[model samples]
Target: MTRLRWCLLAIATLLASVLAVPPASAAQDPAPILDPIPDDPAPSGLGLVLQEVARLPKSEPSAPPTDPRLVRWNRINHVGELPDGSGRLYVPDLNGKLYFLDKKTRTPSVYLDVKATFDPDFFSAAGLGQGFGFVAFHPDFKRNGKFYTAHVEAGNALTTKTPDLTPQPKTGFHGVIDEWTATDPKAGTFSGTHREILRIGFSGRIHNVQQIDFNPNARRGDADYGKLYLAVGDGGNGNVGDNGGDPQNLAVPQGKILRIDPSGTNSANGKYGIPADNPFAGQAGKVGEIYAYGMRDPHRFSWDTGGSHRMFLAHIGEHEIESIHQIDAGSNLGWSEREGAFTFRKDDRCHLYPLPADDAKYGYDYPVAAYDHDPPANWDCASDTGHAISGGYVYRGKLPALRGKYLFTDIVDGRLFYTNEREMKQDPTGQKRAQIYQLAAYDTAGNPVTMKQLAGDNRVDLRYGSDAKGELYLLAKANGKIWKIVGTKQYAGCKPGPKRVSHVAAAKNWAPVTPSKWRFPGREVILAEEGVQRPGPRRPFEYAVLKSGPVFASARIDAEVRLDTPVEISNRDVIIVFGYRDDTHFYYAHLSSDNTIYPHNGIFVVNGADRLRIDQQWNANRSHGAPPAITDEKWHGVRVTHCAGTGEIAVYVDGGARPVMTALDTTFGSGRVGFGSFDNIGRLRDLTVRGTPAE
Candidate 1:
């Protein structure tokens, strides 16, 4: 077998063994292990949770002479919050118009008409991906009335004389970013002064300048407060062989995340000022306008306010992987060379190339999260592969269950998937597949709606939007409809008991329930595993249970433990078992060695007689962090927190604020807190538990 096949096979074997339930008692029948992968996506048709709050009003053309496709493709692209706190959302369409939807009145009205003067025939031949790309209300829009937009306009459509607006030889298209000032902030419509900030002369209609967003929440004096970040795709004519050189070449503006001072004039061209802190602003031989290069078509990107102002980029891939990159200034995400942590060559577009064993050496930054087009048939993911990636926001809504999860989607399939941002950050190398779960959305009538259903079996072209309150919204481009995401909880399959509080901070509070030597000082509790042979099936999950009398519906547990033995003694781990509904139903974090040879480390869930690996780390998109040298005879701290209402479990190691591993499941309600490993030798100390009791 090829090396890739061998690696896949080993991963499959390790996952299969991890899910095997060892015999607890000889009298129990042989329990079956669940399939680690599903052939197709399975839907939970609970209810139609998407309600149609608004739709774009019909447009009257100045002239009735244009192609008919514009009616379908010229649909709504995004919904962004206005700076004014009137609870209004600006929905930008592909036809160069912006519609404002009022949250209170549940109505829509024209906010700005970009095509009011441009001829209708000029828009008829516009590229499929052309039109008004996106809009950004200035951070000080309420005060300055200044905002920017990125759009595709005919050459000479605007009276801008910038170098970027130079006419393209083939398409005569110019991608433009214009700054507009609203005469009145509270006016129902916009009649503003337009200034061409920057423009790019493009070879084709697609892959034009797309987004113009300022950090909405950046404080007045913050470093990133007034800077506008622009994302431009590589203007490559793919019909010919001109595929994406701009992303890798840094001297130009295309295929890059650019940072500029829209209101300042410190640039070489003086149209806009390049941010002094940009990654390449002062670097010799690099364009000062470039922030970070190497992207094919960054179809959409968003600044995470809930995070530390980190920008997440979603790039449309070439023939294979669609990627979501966590961008840091000066980062060089390899495109035309690397796609989603793997090698990509324009000459060998049809063949798959292995990722370099050491990718960082090449100075190429990979996505914290990425998915391939070809995944094994059995892996239980949204899909083993997908077409284009639609960028989304980090859920900061009131739902305690959805917070901290980044929700992104696939355009071809319209399948919504999410991964914990904390988990992706831990696997920065992109070696670990980011765990992805398909979101089962429903219509307002409680009818289950699949992406295909919403797309009318056509290209879904799924796009995401956020309201003034940060609640997420979904836009169906094919249908020209807006959807508000609503649900009481996520994956509500398990029952949550009454709220109860429990805490066990003293060392003597934990009671040993298995073969063990327990020692307790005032500050710590140590349990040394005895060389006792487990008398049952070879189930790795059948750990020796050490319980604390704290029943929990949701809680956090912190403990410090040291591995006394070397990692060579088989699949040994320092496990933190929680949500213990019974001896059979519980969850555990298997903190194992950084054993490169065996990829058996991750979180697992036990439901009745069956055990499954629910954590994102074990499958095709495993986000499990690389194992650390835990067997070095050192004390490593472990913290685990679970919210029953959200069915979210986060595992933190070494007192890090972010979780190294995360999983979501509402299988069991309340259970005792326990600590143990699967037939492993370890030392546990400083055990403490704090949480709501499961009644």
Candidate 2:
């Protein structure tokens, strides 16, 4: 057969396989199928909505007020939630002011003024990416009131001259990550502590320290808990061309991702502690702080807390391809040597570095996803793919269709793309894997608006943010707007069925009817009494078991819970009991509390009234982030799946595809399932559990 005929046959076969599934039943499946390549990838207009949150503060009179820089009108860079759990949004402008907006009231206020505290002259570069870079609240910020900020500082004190061309000490400034504390976190202001955590010096000011963040879910015992990850650029001195050597150099902090304990003192200067597990720690002749190296400018990166804790970073490419990478601890992201899976050379006009025959020996970490620039003949205008790439989160929000999709966008063109995280890793070439989709954002009029159009300009400078609930937002620096992403509820051909085998609700019709359904007795046991069920107050061993009839070896259990009061970590737990063989033998999971062994949370098996954590690999010091906040009053979706055949147990929250906790153990075969808590008052509803019938 001819090549064309063979291709046609292949397409027909794929179509048959996909179209064979009935649309009515497809929605019942646990996973959703995405259009690998939509026929009209850039169909007509838009599909998303952008709502402006707040505008930046007006420029001061002392500066050139008329200049656009003074207005900082459209330069909103980053957005995050405060640790106080107030649910307010915090935004940083490149001009040096930290603005906080209470989304509920739609009011914006200055939370902290970095320019006023630091010498603005040091960060007074004309570039758009300069000045105050980013801020991250410590994981324990709620309790410790500690936070860190990355900004440009005036002094070259931390910089060492490069020996040859007009020593950098005289020509460069510094990028500093300063730790600050708030005596009263609710006061909306920071205490003037200002402890210097780390600093990167630059000959020119484009790629300074870009971001500082801690794993929000990290608990005390997790490896990543209290560890701050900082990304630095190659100290690009645009004034004199690239004064480059930092990305590949280990001694300097620039062009690398550094992980340090913000609260511990183990450094030579005793400011911060070097994580013992860092990739370069204890290595000879290398900086112990380096987590990964050889990066030009890793502008933005986020941890996939809802999934595998893998980090995805969006690195700006040099001339041709913009790239995205999933980094490993000691991974070497080739920068000066390569760019976005392509060879990169500063001096080469048609810059292309030939891949070495023995590339594996180089220990280079190539981008998992990338898009080439337009104007193939000569690099000219922005191609269909935008110029700069912006990193985003793995969508684990309430949007069922978007679950597990890694969302990213172009800073210049403002085109947002969502790719299957698993697929991206499986097919790194990204050719057959799946080309990035231009997420269509629409307005109330049903008119499709380009991301650039939403920002009212081509220079969107798009950035992404995720609230505590994992809902994502897009920040348009050029338009000075924040867009909350709202996905279509009923996904095409993937809407969940109405009569769920696992339907749960907090209403009367769904209440437990028999003694066997809710068979535990305790003082706080109000199982579905007043429109809700309290298995027991948060206390030790207070459990309400569903001792009714059904039992299974493999099962899927889902429950909706609401915390009536605050959660005290030391004495609070939302436990889901499963695989119960008897009263003294069963498996239960602490869904949202930290314990010493599995700091974040884990599953424990009770044998003869003796409880032992079965999933130690996912326990404390092994996991990242604190447990999910189970007592926040908002209805939280909890799911537990166990397959005895594979001895695999997985847990999910908020309908996220990614399992927050997982383990494989065959200690117990099958039994009953139930729900309860430790020392906290919470309401539970929709306790629906389904599995194959027991023999």
Candidate 3:
């Protein structure tokens, strides 16, 4: 017993034989038999369903040597986008599965498993939990495939060696939100139908509620189109109870954000309803499923792809502030009596109040972005540097080259910033300047932050995404990588030879090109092109593959490249190609010889039988930090490839994954690539070169 509890008792005996099977019903009364042909009114035409294809040939250029078996499964924690566009990712381990992934071939599968739905005492009365928020769906989720989830449940009569001293099972709460249905939203597997809508209960063990979402302004046939919104948090250690922020209390719902409406008709008091436009429905006795209220650990929240009904929260503070608010409907925010724009436990004695004075004009809302902990401006929050601020989004789609920038971070110094509400209200003494980067940040706040010279390390957790045109995506919560936000055309005077990598063939018209020549003292630089097309929220193109010694290496092809920071050459021979804009972290695509630097952590790929060392780490503070080798205005990526006799290396990214590092000994023979903005500012696209043979 041990090996992680024998892999958790063989994944709880393979999820109890895949939940013992049962589903599949489309209603009885089957049968068709018949022949009735009438009225061929000779005036009808409307048919087109084509399906038949076979065209394969042009994809040559394959010097083999690039497969090293690859294996990485840190297991997902959160991932989305499935309004039909596909892609669902969620794996709160402890055998709590949900999977799905396949936005084409990201390959995943599982579907659902919490011990086959529930009741082995649900895991010995509350003791095997996992699965925290984000599933929702239901905009008619492709014609009623429904969908909902908010997990965290266990059982064993409730533990403590039980004996019914009021032992668990008051419906076994520890946070539950269920809903399910999916008999087939284009099929993958999870023969749906389950029910249990709301349950909330947790005396400790951190925040709990986690996420829910679904209300991008909602509408299409209304009725709150599946209204949800949740968020919770403030149940763990950080004092507040006494009925927390009292929304008039209802025996505690913990610091609130709810919303409900799961289809309506309130089933005898809970299973969803409360939505007469919410805001205390009929007042008098409140709790109509709260919409907003003072929060103390709200984690993450978003909605603002431009349509602007605006929404964005990310509270979480205990010592000094760390905020980002603006969300209404019943608004209250100002937990423990304000902690962001200032004033917290101010002289204790309780009794504090003051919101609604244009608190962002009416319904309470302040913090388009915040940061504080006393300092010469951020001396690593002085001490206790863990968890505070991790909510991001705002760069509405089609990268008009990063239109409107907003992004956000700080799950323990994975600091990556970007501002724009007019530099966040003219920089409130916090100085205005953002375009900062150190391998695109990630470290899900479990306490981990250290970096002064940036070496390499990660626990990844930058979770949050959106695509299918609404743009936004940043999920390197520790390496599930997926970044999308692009823009280019900023080269200074380009002229770092290798034929400028053949002018990167103009990146296929998504247009916005640049590169005529800039400060290039070269090590290798290229930017050639051929039908590029990668950037997305929808697709665009440019070209970049730069580097500039003194310590500023680089790489840029947009769509992916985030490595937080740390690079050591020592003996040369590096490569790049990255992905994992979230799931912890990993982002790069760097190479060298003439120019190709994108080093947030010199993209790793070692394992010549067994050497394992995949670099990238940068923190602002935590158990002594270092390894982000700064170089003024930072930007990095470098690449190296040599075929035959076995050698393949890679690190390409704008978001994550392309990592492939193997070795036999080729130490980059014959140089000359292109692009090097070592002076700062960068951009690039598709530049290609394969197998290298003709001299």
Candidate 4:
């Protein structure tokens, strides 16, 4: 199997094995299965209606602030801000280059090239896994220049007379935590000194250790300055023996958050000393480093601003949940015992040991916020569609607009919500009294605004950070865009210009594409098109096609079209009349720049005819045969007509009736048309795209 496939399989197998084992605690009564919420009903009316409060006025600072420039990196899994006011973004790319972003410039530069810094054989021998963790700067980083990282390291072979069945060779440490020192403390960059702090072995990648965060509130000048809090996921393959959720276990460090002082001592394996205050430091068999235990996939977590009595952990779950737990020493989070307030295995027969009724609450830690699979509010966890929760810090910054709010987001849903400590405490019983408002839209001035509807919703995991003063920043996962929530009051009520409808004709120089004409709700737009005479070398090309609606569409072209290069018809529609024509077919539909196809099922052309026809019996399909013949070498007029009720599609080529098909559903809805090579090459000309909303 491919490496990626192997990794995925390993992860799946691990999860299965971990969860398949019966929980230690089994209940006498049958487990309570919460009733699923109705799909169409409005959200439960239990919470405070935030809409009833007066809307906060948009900030009106004199000079509008500039948009924060986004830093680009390969597979940025997490980000953390230094206490010294600088930001460090960690990318666990396959190649293992650690990147640092300068908060001021929003530019990314390599902080540490693991390949160059570590012994090359380390990875070759250990069999490096995907870079899946984080790098944390010491609390007193200004003077200490110490930072720590958690990552996968190959482990030594487990020598048994009988061979193991798992794919992992008898060799390799699945995960390791390392501490390094910067060469120069005064320098603004990270290319200074280096050191290996510690290494912990794991079985595989899944449930590997994720991040290490320092207690921001820890004593600054004390020996604890470089002491760290490490969040380790249940070590790969969810084996109960990994001791993932059991805080009492001593043989394994799989599920625990470890506390250590990097400068303290040297052990048989490496450097770093365990803090005496660590929960289990003096215990006989337990790893002295563990601070707390009982967590699933602790992908990301953070200490609140000002660091007093608050920490957030985003725990990944299997079915029905993802949670944010508040940290406390010796906390038993009930991983195999429970998943986010719900019992996973409740039958007494399923377990060898029974846990207390309040297992998760027995220890010092508890989940501050937890949600189930319900929609319109909590993330859709039951579907297992959401992957991980990306924990974020509470916004305790200089920006008056977002101060005093706890901001956290899910990596899978891209939803941002804020809650007060009081509100979070009240959500334990699956009942909430506070409204979690969606951060719907941002005004042009960059102020947050509640929209009539949510837009641009996608699975863009948002990474969070804060500056020295604790101002909040967001890193969008989809495009690596960075947005700073700033106060702005300058609003120019400018209307958009007219739409330039065709690619065959040259775009009028500097013409404005009006918001109304372009059919987008936004205030600005620019229209441009390019046509190539000769086919370029086969390569991926990114293009933006504008449609007069809410969606953007894109596509790739491997071959030619209309007697040019042979175009492969990957996407097609026979129902909509006016769409792009590839070599094999005319789309007869509007496509968004993001590759969303919309069918305008109103118009159609008689099959094999040179006459335009409006037919209600048209059907849309991907395999509708070759596009109608084009008379000219370049530029052909195409029209699509759709009938919503009849589910018909008609296509006209150069105003001549051509093909008609019946759509399985309504073919047309009023929306703009966007066409171009999504990630590959193709050409366009004479594209007159228009739309009217479905009435």
Predicted candidate 1 versus true structure: per-residue lDDT over 243-290, tens digit per residue: 446567776666777888987898765778878888777887787877
TM-score of each: 0.62, 0.60, 0.26, 0.54
On the 0 to 100 scale, the lDDT of residue 447 in model 2 is 40
- Decide which is better by TM-score, 2 or 4: 2
RMSD of each: 14.0, 22.0, 27.9, 20.4
* Model 3 lDDT tens row, 1-695: 47999999999998887775444333332222111111111100111111111111111101221312111123233455677655443333222456666665555666766545764433212221233445667767777888887765545534522221111223233667778888887787778687876766655545657777787666787755678888866555324443344322432456678787888866234456777887776665456677887776787787765645477777776665566766777766656555554434434422222232334432334465665433223434234534456766666766564456556666544454444533443122222223222222212311122221121234333444555466554444333444433322211111122222223333231112344432222322332222233332211123233221111112122221222122332212222332212111222233322122232223332222221233332112221111222222224442333322222223332222222221222332233233222222233334443322224
Model 4 scores what on Cα lDDT? Answer: 0.45
lDDT, model 3, position 199: 66
Arrange candidates by lDDT, descending.
Answer: 1, 2, 4, 3
| Cα deviation of 6, candidate 2, in Å | 56
Candidate 1 residue runs with Cα over 4 Å from true position: 1-48, 58-74, 120-126, 155-162, 165-172, 237-244, 375-386, 426-429, 454-457, 490-695
Query: Tens digit of lDDT per residue, candidate 2, span 249-359?
Result: 777666888889877888765788899999888877778888998887788999887777788888886655667788888877887777765555555534454454556
Which stretch of 10 consecutive residues in model 1 shows the poorest summed lDDT?
36-45
lDDT for residue 522 in candidate 3, whole number 0-100:
35
Q: 1 or 2, which is superior by lDDT?
A: 1
List lDDT for all candidates, in order: 0.66, 0.64, 0.43, 0.45
How many backbone clashes does every candidate have?
13, 29, 121, 73
lDDT of 4 by residue, 1-695 (tens): 59999999999999999998777644254444443211111111011111110111111111222311111122355545665644443333323556556554556666666644543322322211234356777777777777776655442222321111112222234455666777775454566666556555445545666777776665757644567877866654443443334423544566678777777773334466777777777777677777777666676777775535477677776554667777766666666565665555523312223233565354334356654444323334333445456667777776554555566665656655555554555233433333332233344433233221121335564556555566565555344445555542211111122222333223331111222121111321212222222233221122233433332122111111222222343332111223322221223332211121222223232222222323222212221122223323343454444323323333344544223222223323222343332222233443443332333
